[model samples]
Target chain A: MKPGPFTYHDPTELADAVALIGAHENARALAGGQSLVPMMNFRYAMPDHLIDLNGVSGLSFIDCGERIRLGAMTRQRDVEFSSDLQHAVPILREALLNVGHRQTRNRGTIGGSICNLDPSAEMPAIMLLHDAELTAQSTRGVRKIPMNKFALGFMTTSLEPDELLTEISFARWGKGHGYGFHEYARRHGDFAICSAGVLIEADSRGEVARIAIVVGGLGATPVRLSAFEAAAKGHRLADELIAEAAAAASRMDALSDAHFSADYRRHLAGVLTRRAMKSAFERIGVAAYV
Target chain B: MSVNGRTYERDVEPRMLLVDFLRQDLDLTGTHAGCEHGVCGACTVLVNGRSLRSCLMFAVQANGASVETIEGLANADGSLSILQECFHDHHGLQCGFCTPGMLMTLTEHLRENATPDEQELRVVLTGNLCRCTGYQAIVEAGLDAARRMRAKKEAAE
Candidate 1:
């Protein structure tokens, strides 16, 4: 047995779910339960009422329009296998594959993953790099939140109790695109001690137009190093320049954990940034942050 | 809520984890709880088609949900699927503790990707932890099954 006794309610409609959350201040919206379930088991989270959102159907589609709109309830496995996502945001699809193991990914939702907001998570870095916008709903109505502001701290997000994440949107990346999502964990499928995600865009001349390098799992939230991005503003991809940029990027934030000390994480940050940027450059030669 | 297609709608303590609920309350001992935390996947189950760690989930969490344990992997006749047959052929299991969870996950995987590569197979079975066989036999079993499965498809076509 765990901690608090809670009432369970599965609302079929979005509005009903929002209303239930609004009414119960301590209620939680359960998406995949990959994180929430374990927390409850450990008595880490004591939600009075559990608002299970599995009944909210059709909320797990990856729609490609002006922006890639991924329903908040979409599972990590769903995103990993999405052909539409593979064609559009290949980086995200690749990143989705990096989330935990296949079994966890099968039941872990993209929204739920971000909502849990583990610092070393790959999805949040992907979202931050793409400048993804999150749609949060409540009894008061809906609000569009940016990636930077969405993730607050370790296992912390800006999402209010009354608000449920409805969708995550980012400008689509077309074909002929290159991408890479890289992270270093103690073992495969374990939480990354340090991770890096890179996204780059080219101009009409095919020169580098945009560069977004995001590092997560090493901070309270995904942190984008502006100094490093500035280094890549207009120059072509070069090794020395990339190394300098990665060093500058690593200087921004160094996370500390028992397994990996702050200095080690800093070293990992720079190394991963270099590798991620190289692979990404090799791929768009390809791909951000919070 | 029911497990392995068996229904039990009695009142239970909120603190009881779904894994314990299945093993102790329901008496379906196939659902083994390894590493009470989420690290080990030995306690994995299909909670509404998605494999999740039962140790991490509370019994109340599955109130409106459907969960499939190792006991539900086979048909009513209790015959093993081809996936299981491949495991046996490849000597995939050693201690046989992680076999139930591994088989459940691999079965679902083959259903989706009949032809999975080595890398794909590795990532797919990442959740289930095994201390025996060094995973070569299990991964070999999955790959071997994929080849046979593809050949069967080609023959049918």
Candidate 2:
């Protein structure tokens, strides 16, 4: 299906792009056009103007320093293949592989995925895991938002019509931090039915010094299992401890759809939480206490 | 737009998808459009040398960009390219609906990782869905093409 007619604006400068979108009431920024284009084709999104960011300069970059920063227009495939990201934040790379296929990732951008805020998107869940900082730019000025507060609901973000997500930054994990990402879909490269991402750091005693688990595709937005994290924190890695955490995680409310019942997703939430935690612990080179 | 090494400039509507622009305006019908929402990879093309779903892009979005479609997969002398020949030699295609997309996708994949094992080849082929041949022949064809391309490069050097 063809999309509705709209004026296309290709702004060569970031300022010009912002100004263009700010001036139009129903204008939408075009990042990778992976999600928005499909929605527009179906007339689900009927923007009167399209502000294409591809022509905007200086918005596609990956910088790794004290904190990792990714420009909004950076493609997912670029992140997947980046040696810097692979070294500094391997979890992001691992999660990115579970996104769409190579062709889609070749065109999908990090900003697009985050801004679209699909309940099952990997980038948002990864952001939740790292407490990633997001920068939004508009004609007014710039506002920094924590990733947790960025997405308001399903397929909805806190981004104002006049604003564009400019950059995302996350702290580099310290040494000995291990990350695990796992998602269950009907087929390879499909959207997850239930997904889990775990980050663990062992203290001197090799117990669970710090842990964060974020689950996606089972709720209106990516959910941070804080209760589960708190339950497992400072506890020795053991089957019983993991089960307790998983059970707490499963108790959280999740969405139910035609494909998966709520009970099934809840079950998956528990199973995936356990698996991700185990995988993360293994990466840290520690055996789970039987 | 410079498509298949030929430059053509035409005013297009923002609503017009690249696949439509290719088929209707440019008459480059080799690039098939299937499942316009991007689930099926039949509308795949190379935008600036990277594989992209043409169906998911507006024609205007591709303005001033270089696009390579299935029409350019043949040699200038009109013979099949090595990848295409491998498909024919290995019976990679049955109904031929997904052949073009498969070709464009593998063309990009083989360029990056010249030699992919069978498992890796299957992983790469997951993007393009072929209804026939059960994917075994397609994987074989992709592996065979990678070998031939590597050999050709080695011979040239």
Candidate 3:
């Protein structure tokens, strides 16, 4: 099945796009058309109007200065292979590669992924781990929203009808930090049934500075395990610490879908957490090679 | 609109998918639609030199875009392109549904890299799925095509 009849408009300016969507409450903004088009075909969603953001170029850049700024329309493929992201935020690069296959990554935009707000998305988990900020634009003006507050519920977000995600910005991964994402899915290009992203910062002498363990594919939005991170702080990636964090994650209300039960998700959460930490440890070892 | 170096103009519904517009409307059925939901790569096509899921795009959206489908790869003499020949020689296709998309994707890479390693070939052919042949033959075919294309180009130079 294909989408129902609709009018298509390619707006050049961001402001113009906002105006178009604001004028028609039922209109849908087409970012990458990855999630939207699929639903439209099966009649899951039927918007009468579609406003394309492709004409408004220059949204595919990743700027690095005091902070890392990623344009909303940046394709996942670009992020996956970007030397800038590889150097500045290796976790994000890792997350992007594990998104979909190469073709989907080439067409899937970051804004689309965040706006879709899939609970199992890898990049969102990384965002939660780093406390990233999302910038949204509307005719009213631009406003920044914390990643935690951006997603409200399953496939739901705080985005207003008139607003569109314009950019995502975050502090570059702190120096002397090991970042990693680990997840498991039924297939190589499929969404994760359980996923976790970790950020472990170390001091000059290799003493622990701070750490964050955020898990996705577990709730309506990505959740950070501050308690687990705090428990592991000042400690190394020993088996005991990994087990403690794993136990902590196992106690959270992990999501249960048709693919996985809550109990199984909880179990995988602990396993994935341990694996993510192990990956981080290896990443720390190979930092000098890269 | 100009497609594959030829001009084609036709009326289509604004909501009509590009793959449908090609296969049903324009009668270019070489572009297959496998999942229709964009999960399957059967509806792959080149839009302005970039590979895209035609199932996810509206025909109207491709108004001024340059499109190249599997049918467009043949020459005036109706001979198969080097990539197509390699697919036959290497036993790459089975079930035949995924062949066109695979060929289109493989050709694009061959045209660019001319010759690619096995790993590179596998990466470029990732989205196009084949239920049969175990993908080993497909990668071999892609490599075979790329090597021959590179030789032809070098010989011409």
Candidate 4:
């Protein structure tokens, strides 16, 4: 398979890259090319102009300051190996391990995964869990979009044609926050059939002070269990509460694919949510009910 | 791109894959093209010391990058590298279609991790699909190669 003929532009400056994509019609920015290149080879995507972003400066930094800031072009492998990130957000590394194989992760970019917005992609689900803020730049200027409002539909993002995702930043959970990311896939590197991400902060009394739960691969976008999170806040993490949250996750509308039925996905959502919550609870040194 | 310790300058189509450039343009046929998509890691090579799927990258994208391919894995005397030798010793291949990729992938892996556990090697190999050998022999070859490389490093030190 070969990609269709397209003029390629390698821009070293962010402004130049933004201007080129904005100036050309049917232009697509090439991030790590782990996903887009394969689509190009299959002729599923035939952009008339390919704007390569690898040479662009200031798009590959990992600033673990007050907020965890990641440049759009930051490689998944880099994120997986970042000790700072591992300390700040261990769940990210756990999810990233399942994103793809080592070879793909070496070249795959977080920005690409987020902009592609695959329903089963781990990066988007992690961003959703962290409430990440994405910065988009274009000739028109820059704007910040919350991760919750980033994805419009399956493989579709709220980004304009010319806008490029520059950075993703989010506030880190407090120290000792319990986190768990669980997914069930046929193979190790395969996309998850159903995935769950959970983050919990425990109060002094070993009660749940705050919690965030996001289930992916069940619908067009990751479903955030905000209602469950709110209800469970300030309550002890009991088995019944976890079951209730899992039940709520199972009842959410899920997409049915050829291999997996909606019912099966719903069932998996419940099972994985329970497992993820239990793992999160255990991380907080709480004796979760077995 | 500088490939196999030699730098080559050429003009190519923007959409030409790095694998195609290596095989067709540079005549480096050792890098096989299995699944042209990113799934099969048959076209894996080291770009700037990091293993990446050549099929997933365009030739234009590799400009000014140092690439190490299967052709570069051999000794200067035309003999097999330690990894290839371990592959032969372990029967790591049957049809040999996926050997190049497995070698390149492990070459980088061993360089980074002088000693990798069996589970770690298995996880590292999940990217490259080897349908012929069922991966057991390949895993054994990888372990052997790692042990030999570690010994060599220790001896040199």
Candidate 5:
């Protein structure tokens, strides 16, 4: 399986890369080449030009400030290993470890993962959980899109052909924030069958102060359960409340494929949601009814 | 590209994957192309001292990068490397199709974590699949290699 012939452009500058993608018709930006290359080999994608972003500078970095600014080209392995990121947003690390294998992570970039936008990919779910923002650049200018809006559908994004995903940023959660991420896959490195990402913050009275719950591999994109969040808001951590949240998740219109039935995915979604909520509450020292 | 400490220069197609460039053009066939889609990890190679699936990368992408294939894993004196020796002593391989990738993956893992325990080694080897031995001997070999590597490092220090 060989990728079809294409003209390759390795631009060292961000502007040049943007220009290359803009000027070349049917051009695809090659970041980690993890997803695109495999698709190209299968002839699922055949771009006439490849704008290689590997040589682009300033697109692979992590800066901690009021908000965490992650360059699009930052490798997944770097995110897993970054002490700063682990301290700032521990759930990012938790989710990254579940992505692909160590070798793939070494070469796979964070931006590439988000741009790939696999419904089962952990990065999109994590971003959705954090309300992350993505910066897309083109010759015209730069525009920021929320992670929820950035991902349109399976393997589809709002990014135009000429635009490049340059950076992703999310507000840093304050101290006392507890995060839990869990995914079930057939194999260790395989894509998730059903996964859950949870963020929990409890008040002094052990009541829910802030929380975000997003489930992946259940739909075309990671689905956020706002109804569950609203229902659990201001409620004490209790078995009934957790059960209600899980029930709400089960009602989502989860996707059904040959490997998993819609009814089963609905069941697992509830189970995983309950598990993630329990783990998140436990991390905050609030005993959640398992 | 300087592969295994040897330099070679040639014009190649932009879409030519690194695995094809190595096996077909350079005659370095040790890096097998099992899945050719980055799942099997049989085409794993060291690009600039990091393990990468050569099948997922273009030759032009690695133009200035130094590469290391299975052919480079042996000692300069032509003896088996410590990791390779451990694999042999522990029967880590049977069909030997995935051995090159397993060695390349472990080489990078050992370089990072010189004293990885059995559990950690198993996690590291999850990317490289081995069907023949059910991975018992491979896990043992990885732990043995880490022990030997750490001991040698301690002696040098």
Candidate 6:
């Protein structure tokens, strides 16, 4: 398949790219072209102008400090192999290993995945786990949007037409915190039928001080198990407690498709969540009962 | 872009895929195009030393970048590279439609990872689909190639 005809603009500056998108009525920003180009070839997206962001400067970087900041154009492969990210957020690398294959990851970008907002994508769910704040830029100005409020619906984001996602920043979990991510897909590189991401911080007394659980591929957007997180805090991660959280995850709303039923997805959600929680507990020196 | 050690200059349409540019414009037909929507890795090539699906990228996207295709995998004197020879010894292909893509993918994999286990090779190969040979022979070839390359590097050292 071939993409439909359209004028292409490769702006070398961030402001120029933002101006182009803001000026054009139907212009789409081209990040790594991992997802956008495929959609264009399928005729699902036929933007009249393509604002290529590859040439833009200062948009492909990784800054690690109190909070980790990643440029929108930071390639997924880079993120997967970044030593800083692995040390700060090991679960990101673990989850990225399941995001498509090596070839796709070489060109895919963090911003592209978040903007695409595939319900089964690992990046969005991981972002949700970290409570990331995204920076969006436009001709008007820049604004920060919390990850919880970014996704509007299925494959749709709250991003305005003219806004360009610039950077994503999230506070890093403490050194002793443990994180785990799990995804189940039909094929090795396919999007997950259900995915789970867990981050847990244990207090000096070996009890859960803070926990964030995110279940993806079950609904229009990744759902945070806030109720479970609140209920389970200050408690040890026993097998029964993990099972209860998984049960709550399975009862959440899910979308059914031709290949998978909602009930099947829900079942997978429960199984994956349990496994993820167990792994997280084990990482933090807690012995989860079989 | 510099492709296969040669720099080429041409004006292409914005919609023209890199695979089409290589085949139709430069006549580098060894890089086959399959499932142009990026699912099948038959159009995979090295751009800036990283393996990427050529079909997913526009021709202009390769501006000033270096690309390597199947045509460049052979020795400069026209003999097959050690990896291709390993494929030949292990019978890594049947119909040979996916050979180019598989070879290119494994080429990059072996370059970065001097020694990869069977499971790692199999996982890396998931990007390229091979309907024939059941992937067993391909995996064997990859392992064999890795061994040979390691030996060669040791000898050189």
Write one digit per residue (lDDT tens) for candidate 6, span A1-290. Answer: 38889999999999999999999989999998989999998989999999999999999999998899999999999999999899988999999999999999999999999999999999999999999999999999999999999988999999999999999999999987878899899898898899999999999888889999999999888989999899998987678878887898899889898889999999999989998998898899888875
DockQ of 3: 0.65
Residues B117-157, model 3: lDDT tens digits: 99888867777889998899999988888778878889999
- Of 4 and 5, the candidate ahead on DockQ is 4
Tell me the lDDT of model 4 at A209: 89
i-RMS, each model, one decimal: 2.3, 1.2, 1.7, 1.1, 1.2, 1.2
Question: For model 3, what is the error of residue A200's alpha carbon versus the real structure, in angstroms, after optimal superposition?
Answer: 1.5
Give candidate 1 misplaced runs (Cα > 4 Å). Answer: A174-177, A204-206, A285-290, B1-17, B47-50, B56-67, B73-80, B145-157
Give the CAPRI class of candidate 1. medium
Report, for all candidates in order, the number of backbone clashes. Answer: 15, 0, 0, 0, 0, 0
Runs in model 2 lying further than 4 Å from the true structure: none
lDDT of 3 at A159: 92
lDDT of 5 by residue, A159-264 (tens): 9989999999999887868788888899988999988888888888878888899999898999999878876879987777678878888899987898999888
- Compose the digit string of candidate 1's lDDT tens values, residues A156-257: 889887899999999876556545678888888777888888777766565567778888766688888766677677776556656875786678667676
Count backbone overlaps in model 6: 0
Report DockQ per prediction, comma-separated: 0.59, 0.76, 0.65, 0.83, 0.80, 0.82
User: Whose DockQ is greatest here?
Assistant: 4
**Candidate 5 at B129: error in angstroms?**
1.1
Per-residue alpha-carbon lDDT of candidate 4 for residues A1-290, written as tens digits (9 for 90 to 100): 39999989999999999999999999999999988998999999999999999999999999999999999999999999999999999999999999999999999999999998989889999999999999999999999999999988998999999999999999999999998899999999998899999999998998888899999999999889988889888888788878987898899899898999999999999998998899998898876785
Q: Distance (Å) between predicted and true CA of A217, model 6?
A: 0.4
> How far off is residue B50 in model 5, in Å?
1.0
TM-score of chain A of 2: 0.97
Question: TM-scores for all candidates?
Answer: 0.89, 0.97, 0.94, 0.99, 0.98, 0.99
lDDT of 1 by residue, B1-157 (tens): 8676777786787667888999998888998888777777888888777777788777777886788888887656888766777899999999999987887787778877887899888877888889998899999999998888788789999
lDDT of 5 at A9: 88
1 against 2, candidate with superior DockQ: 2
